[model samples]
Structures are given as C-alpha cells and as structure tokens.
Target: MSEKNREGKRTARERMAAEREKHKAAEKRRRALIVGASVVCVLALAAVIGVIAANAGKDDSSDSEGPAVAPSGAQGEDSLVIPVGKAGAASTLVVWEDFRCPACKSFEDTYRSTIHELTDAGRLRVEYRLATIIDGNLGGTGSRSAANAAACAQDAGKFVDYHDVLYQNQPAETDDAFSENAKLFELAAKVEGLDTPAFRSCVEDGTHNSWVAKSNDAFRSGGFTGTPTVLLDGKNIYQDQSMTPEKLKQQVQEAAKG
Candidate 1:
C-alpha cells in the first residue's frame, strides 16, 4: 500500500472514534436530564401529599359533620355560653375562659362565690363562654377535653358544680393533665351525682367535642386572644385595671337599677 493511503485509513478510523465519543456524551446528558426530571416530579408529589395531610389535620380539628350545633339550653351564637343566672335577669355578665388557663383559675377562685351570689339573687345572669386557646398554643388536647367534659356536665344539669371543680383542680398550663378521661370523671365525682355512668360515657365519648370546637371558633371570631375575658353588658370590663370583685358587683347592681 502507499504511505498516503495508509495515513488516510488512520484518519478515517480517528474520525469514527471521535463520533462515538460525541454520541456517548450526548447519551450521558440525556440520562442526567431524565434523572433530574424524575427527582423534581417526586419532590413535587411529596410536597402535594404533605400539604394534603396538613389540611386534613386542620379540618379534623375545625370541621365536622352537619356543622357544630350547640346543645340545648346553651346561650350565645355557638351555644357555648351557659347561662348561670336567672332567666330574666337584668344584666348579662359574659365570661370567656379556658379550663386549663391559670389566670382563669385565679379568676374563678376569686369570684366564683360572688358570681353565684349575684346569680342566685337574680341580680344578673352570667354567661360562660368556653375556649381552648391553650391547646392551639401549647400543643395538647387538655383544653378541648376539659371543655367537652364541662359541656357534658351541662347536659347532666351540673354545669356550675363541674365548672367550679375543674377550675379548683386545674392542672398546670404545660401539664396537659385534663386530656385524660379518668381524671375528668374523678373530678365529676366531686360534684353531687355527676359521676354517674352516663356522665362517664359522655366524657369518654367526647360527645361535646364538636361543640367545644365551635366554642373555640366563637372565641376566635370574638377577637379575644386570651382567657378570663369578662364582659358586662357587652363591655369588656376585664380590660379595666381597677375592676375588682366588689367593683364588678357594684356595676351589676348599678346596671340593675338603670
């Protein structure tokens, strides 16, 4: 063969090799794009699933079948407010509270007797609005559970007694102790005839849980951030620094007169 012909054959071979290298590089890039697309799709799907689960959880806490209907004898829009005074009393004292709130316990301990005295005399009616702000803020079910139990007590015609007992034995804010059914029944036993099987069943079943949720929703919509919010004839007296038990009683009497 001629030397030039041999060199031409070598050059052809080199050209073919370079083409094969280019094809391999293009194939690798295609595979890399495919892998990256798969990864992105998987991440998007996971994020969608995560969002769905989170929304479902929120619905479980907030939504319910047939909406939350307030129980019988309940006052206020959501029926969370249990009236504690005479049917035709002159003034309405509304109290928004959470069973697990320490400040609420203090308010109860200080003014429970005064409230009852006023109510018994038909001087004013006290409306109790239950709330579960602690559960949302602190990550637990104690407030909801206690509120359910209280509503159950309302059904059994022992709301005031149960309310007093709950505040009297309120657990620390961080303890979440009221999340237990047994503890609630035990406290119910303190109230005369409140620890019956029916009461226990109601508490265990959480029959009023939805109602409690409704109450919390009402509290949120009422635009109050904390518990023990006391209102006199729609006025927020609890916000007043000088408001004491005596002052509250005086205000009620004065309202009664006018």
Candidate 2:
C-alpha cells in the first residue's frame, strides 16, 4: 500500500478506538446512574431471593406517638386495616402498603381504576394495612403521617378519595413531603369535606398513629419482605409477572361468582 494510504488507515483505526472508548465511558455513567437510583429504594431482605424493595422495617421503630385509636369502621386484627368496598364482597385484597413508597404509588396508579371498579361493583374488598417502612428506613415521618392522614379521612367516610389524592401527588422517593401536617391538610382540601375541623384534629392529634405503628410492626413480623405486598385471596399476586389489571379484575369477578 502507498505510504499515504497506510498513514490514513492508521488514523482511521485510532479514531475508531477512541470512539469505542467514548461509548464505554457513556455506558459506565449510565449504569452508575441506574444503580444509584435503585439504591434509594432497595433494602436487602433475609430469606427472599431477588426481592428488590424499599425497607419493610429498619432498625428504628415506627412512630408510636399516641394511643391506638382505631378509626371508625376500621376492621381486621388490632383494627389495623382500613377497609374499603362492601362488607360482603367475596374476595379480599390484603395490601401492606407504604404511603411514602414509590412502588406503592406506581402500583396504585396502575391498578387504581380496576380496584375502584371492582369495589364499586361490590366484587372485591380491600384491606389496606398501612406501613411506615420508609420512615423507619429513610429517617422521616412521612410514611406514618400520610397513613395517619388517610385514617383521618376514613373518619369522614372519604378514605379512598384522600388515599388516591396522596398517591397522585406523591413526592420523590427520598423526599419526605408528607411529614408535615400542613402538607397533609393541604392535600385533604382537595377531597371536598376531608379538610374539616374533625379531620384536622384527628390528624393533629395523631389519633391512629399507634394503630399505624402496630400495623407496621405486623408487616415486619409477617415474614413478607417488601412494601406494596399485595395479596389477593391470600395469594401474593404481585409477584405474578402476568398479573395485569384486567387479569385481576377477571379473577375477582370469578371469585365473586363462586
């Protein structure tokens, strides 16, 4: 080959190598970003394989700041559940959820319509057992406080509305926006009569704070190692990769017919 051609080929190879190095650098940065984002919400759990989740319980205890005043109409053991849907519904969806959990919000966003439809049709009942794992793990009272606010809404016969509002306006995974009663009240205002004096008092007094703590304790002790642990008819359906909203609705309808 000509000397000029040889020189040009060598330059082209060097340029190609440099481009490859640049691509490798970009991929490294991308992977680092992904891993860092996951770390914000992942907690290692014993006895669970490949279970990525926010903390179910950290070393610190939940905020047990008051007496365990069960919200009016709450059911289940220790009055830990805020029940929604009809009393005679055939299937019960037991949800161990954290208000501060991003995953919980995602689940709600995905399945809220189907859940509401089933509940409205009286085909499904939901037992929402709130947990404060984020507070216990991430050093904030947002989880417990938000759950308390939702309980307070239950007193006004508007738990589902307020619950949806909170998740709809959920903050970033690490942002503890729900720690403030003012924020809770602000959101409650969007739920029509939910921002009433009684509701505010219930939230301010933390009437169900102890109940929420008890519920969180149950979650940690239940050997279920994640937030948003959704059980349909006593089966952990959230782990089912094929479980979609339509599938869930069909299952509930079938159960209702049985």
* Candidate 1: C-alpha lDDT: 0.85
- How far off is model 1, as Cα RMSD? 3.2
Say which candidate scores most in TM-score. 1
Clashing pairs in 1: none
lDDT of 1 at 243: 82
User: Relative to the unseen true structure, what is the C-alpha lDDT of residue 130 in candidate 1, on a scale of 0 to 100?
Assistant: 85
TM-score versus the correct structure, for each prediction: 0.85, 0.76
Residues 1-258, model 1: lDDT tens digits: 999999999999999999999999999999999999999999999999999987763533342445564655897664667888797888988899988899999988888888888999999898898888888878788888898888888888999999999999999999898999988988998999989888888888778788888888778887895888998899988788898889988988887798
Candidate 2 vs. true structure, TM-score: 0.76
Off by over 4 Å in 1: 1-42, 45-63, 66-69
* Candidate 2, poorest ten consecutive residues by summed lDDT: 45-54
Where is model 2 more than 4 Å wrong at Cα? Answer: 1-61
